[model samples]
Target: MRIRPITRDEITELVDDLWLPFAGEMGDIDEYDALAEDVDVRAEALDYRRTQLDDDETQTFVAVSDDELVGYTTVAYSESPPVFARDSGAKVKDLYVAPEARGEGLGTSLLERAHEWGRDRGCARISLSVHARNDAARSCYESMGYETRYVKMDRPL
Candidate 1:
């Protein structure tokens, strides 16, 4: 498998594969279904990713095997709040590997690339959010040395 930064012309292809991760999340969390119902997700995702193509602070990477697009990740540079000790950090906005590609380590490879990108930009840390109930993903992240730094809770009124 080869991993590289995606070009503008390939944004459509990347967007096409986005549903794999989205569907997975929807299946793993009930809240995502409500979230999806509230927006035109496909169009919104396409528009957002398109904007990242020309933004220096953001990056999108794709993994291909046998000339077929299989997985992707998007990461961006972020500034910490004034109360935080760190001035800047890297946030992994999204990371998804196709179901058929899960056991391969594509996720780890993609995350390593994100780490390299953040390090190059002089980021003090890297962070990402994961659904509380997604055990598979949480385990994968934990194995990669990611720790839970905060929790967000909600109750319906």
Candidate 2:
């Protein structure tokens, strides 16, 4: 298995692979289902990724095994607000691994690449969001030394 920056030719496949994670989220959370019903997520993701392909501040990485795309992650650099001590940080927009590919360390490998990318760009911190109910993902991130810096609470209307 290898993890590398996604190529233009592989964008469609990457978008297609996104369904695995999206579907899981939709099934696991009511909010995700409501949101997905309101938008064409696949198209939005494709366009979002395409725009980042040439942008220096953003990067999308894919994990391939046996010539098949198995996982992906997107990271972006941004400056913190004036209130923060750190000037800049990197945020992971998305990260997913296929069910069959889970437990093989693809997620960690992809994140490690994101770390390298952020470090190369002089980012002071790296951040990502995992759904509150995504226990597996939260556990994995916690094991990797990620700590929660904020909590987003919602009261459904």
Winning candidate number (lDDT):
2
- Show model 1 residue runs off by greater than 4 Å: 20-24, 33-39
User: Which residue pairs in candidate 1 collide?
Assistant: none
Worst 10 residues of 1 by lDDT: 28-37
Cα distance off (Å), candidate 1, residue 137: 0.9
Per-residue accuracy of model 2 over 46-116 as CA lDDT, tens digit each? 78778989898999999999999998889999989999776699999889888899998888999999999
List runs of model 2 lying over 4 Å from the truth: 19-27, 33-35
lDDT of 2 at 5: 94
TM-score of 1: 0.89
TM-score of each: 0.89, 0.89
Query: How far is 62's C-alpha from truth in model 1 (Å)?
Result: 0.7
The 10-residue segment of model 2 with minimum total lDDT is 28-37
- For candidate 2, the TM-score is 0.89
